[model samples]
Target: MAEIQPVIEVCDLCKTYYMAGGLSQSVLKHISFTIYPGEFVAIMGHSGSGKSTLMNILGCLDRPTSGTYQLSGENVSDKDDEALAIVRGQKIGFVFQNFNLLMKRTIADNVSLPLIYQGVGDEERRQRAVEMLKKVGLEGYEDRLPSQISGGMQQRVAIARALINNPSIIFADEPTGNLDSKTSDEIMELFAKLNEHGITIVLVTHEDDVADYAKRMIKIMDGEKAYDGLRADYKENQGA
Candidate 1:
């Protein structure tokens, strides 16, 4: 059998911010990891732990000051802004704590927004949006405005939007932060289902319960990797 290629590869990743008056703060310190296709991984840390900064770089929304990030075998760490945008549009999907939908737009329109950037025709975009919505258990919701739905349903719509582009990986940041426990579980279940179908998911959260849904966990503390291993093992070690 042929060896499976990693969907995401990071090596000695480092990020720093230079503020005014010549003060600079290092955010990520030589972070290294690899994520294979179809893996469900959670990145966890407290506020100011650099997890969010790592997420930003992994999602292609920002670049690391040094080190390498290869997405689906493409070196993206040094890519220009326009090139990064193209990489994100082609290879990544993002779900945020806030649904980030246009309240006035119909659900289908929001889900199909990425396709619009790719210049897909209206009819095709609608069809694809409907398909993605159905995948997220929101069939027949295409015409409804975001305001008409419950928070969980709005999150489902966001997941549908993330899937619209057929991305190789999805980066979810605090995806269940705003929902109640029941609704958060539902959203996590939806992510699990998506992962079962071979979609790679990288979830970022501070909540242990939410992180429990993922098979593997990578914990960051004070700009360094604190742990990187199976979630079950992490929990066991914690309990020991």
Candidate 2:
């Protein structure tokens, strides 16, 4: 009988960076949107389009200069770094284009790093890492070093690492930027499976093929929301 809550809500959000000459450049201009639970959304934009800045704010890695950002009902726009870090660790998972794995650590160790920061004990962390890796189809690759794996498998490890925290949302920024098309499709399929399990996913990508995997697409142009609609609507509206 009760209305479900939004996983993320952004209201009139704006971010500006001060320059060397007393100048300021805005990255997000009055951005407003809402993402509900179980949604697979893609934030699409080219370089300098402010999509990266928006991702930083959404993932609690940075704060907005104006307006409000509510993540799971908590106002995060003004949270200090420590507070934001806690929020991010507890509620969000991040996957970067570079895979961001430690080359020297085993895949299992890399996946366990977040739980370590969360104060999880060694045995539990290892167990959870194995579980997550299995989820990402890397069952036997746990003991392998990142350098020993193919680029695609390394990315799978990153995705597994992202899931080990059991976050409410996963924010993947250009997750397939380094992969070949065949491997990129595999990764996107993996993301789709995760989304089906009710974990909210919002990835940033400039490629149409990548964005098409998401149900919803929000196009950012010049630091503003150019379109927010279903992927088909976006395609039709954009004349794709």
Candidate 3:
């Protein structure tokens, strides 16, 4: 059998921000990990724990100050903003807590927004958007405006948009932050279904309940990796 290549690899990753006064604060310190295809991994940390910064780097929205990030076997840690944008368009999908939909736009338009950047034709974009919406269980609502839908439904639209690109991985940052517990559970079940179908998902959240849906967890504390293992093990250790 052929060896499976990791979908993501980070080694000695470090991120530091220099203030205007020449003071520097490091956000991530020498963090390293590998994520294989089809894994549902949660990156857990408090507000100041640097998980957001790490997510930005992994999603190619920002670059690291030092070290390497290999996504699907390509080094993207040092790519310029334009290059990184291209990489993100081609390989990454992002789902955010705020839903991030344009209230004025139709659901189909919002779901197909990424394709507009790629210059896909209008009809094809609509067709693809409809297919993706169906995948997320929002099939007939494509003609509705984002403002017309409930928060969870809007999030489903966001997830549909994320899927339109057929990305190598999805980065979800506090994806359930805006929803109630019941709605959060629904959304998490959706993520679990996506993962079961071989979609690689990397979710970042501070809530243990939210992170519990993930098969594995990587916990960050004060800019350092505090734990990396199965989620069940982390829970067990915490109880011990």
Candidate 4:
């Protein structure tokens, strides 16, 4: 079998912000990681540890101050806003903490948003969106408003929206943050199923249980990677 190229590769990734009060703050410092196709990885860090900054860069929501990033072999470090938008919409599937659904639109409409931005025809977009919704177990609730669904259901809709375009990687930032433990477990199971079917998943989370769902755990501290290894290793060393 041929070796799979990394779906994403980062080298010396850095992000720094200048405070209004004349102080420079570095959120990510020389961070590096690679995500292979079909791998499930979790990024874990404490508050202010640069996990979100790393996520923003990974999702194309922001650019690194200095470093190199390649997504599916395309250089993404210095892309302008418009080009970045195209890459984000086409290559990255983002699942946020708050679900980010449009209140005025129904589930189906929300799921079709990325395709709409891509200039897909209305009929085809709706068809694909509805099919994705069914895949996420929302077959009959296509027309329901986001407010009408429970949190977990809303997340399911979000996941369907993320998958509508068949992206190369799904970037989930605190995806289960708002759910109860049981609901979180269910969501993890859903993510596992998706990974089983060959979708690469990158989850940003702080909860140990949530991180455990991924096959690998990457821990960061003070804007630098403190640990990067298999989840099973972390589990074995939990009490050490």
Tens digit per residue, CA lDDT, model 1, 1-240: 999999999999999999999999999999999999999999999999999999999999999999999999999999999999888888999999998999999999999998887889999999999999989999999999999999999999999999999999999999999999999999999999999999999999999999999999999999999999999999999999
Supply candidate 1's per-residue lDDT for 51: 96
Per residue, candidate 3 scores C-alpha lDDT tens digits across 90-158 of: 899999999999999999999999998888999999999999999999989999999898999999999
TM-score of each model, paired residue for residue: 0.99, 0.98, 0.99, 0.97
Q: Candidate 2, residues 189-231: lDDT per residue as tens digits? A: 9999999999999999999999999999999999999999899
What Cα-based lDDT does every candidate model obtain?
0.96, 0.94, 0.96, 0.93
Tens-digit lDDT track for model 4 on 77-112? 999999999998999999989999999999899999
Runs in model 1 deviating more than 4 A are none
What are the clashing pairs of model 3?
none
Task: List all candidate RMSDs to the true structure.
Answer: 0.7, 1.0, 0.7, 1.0
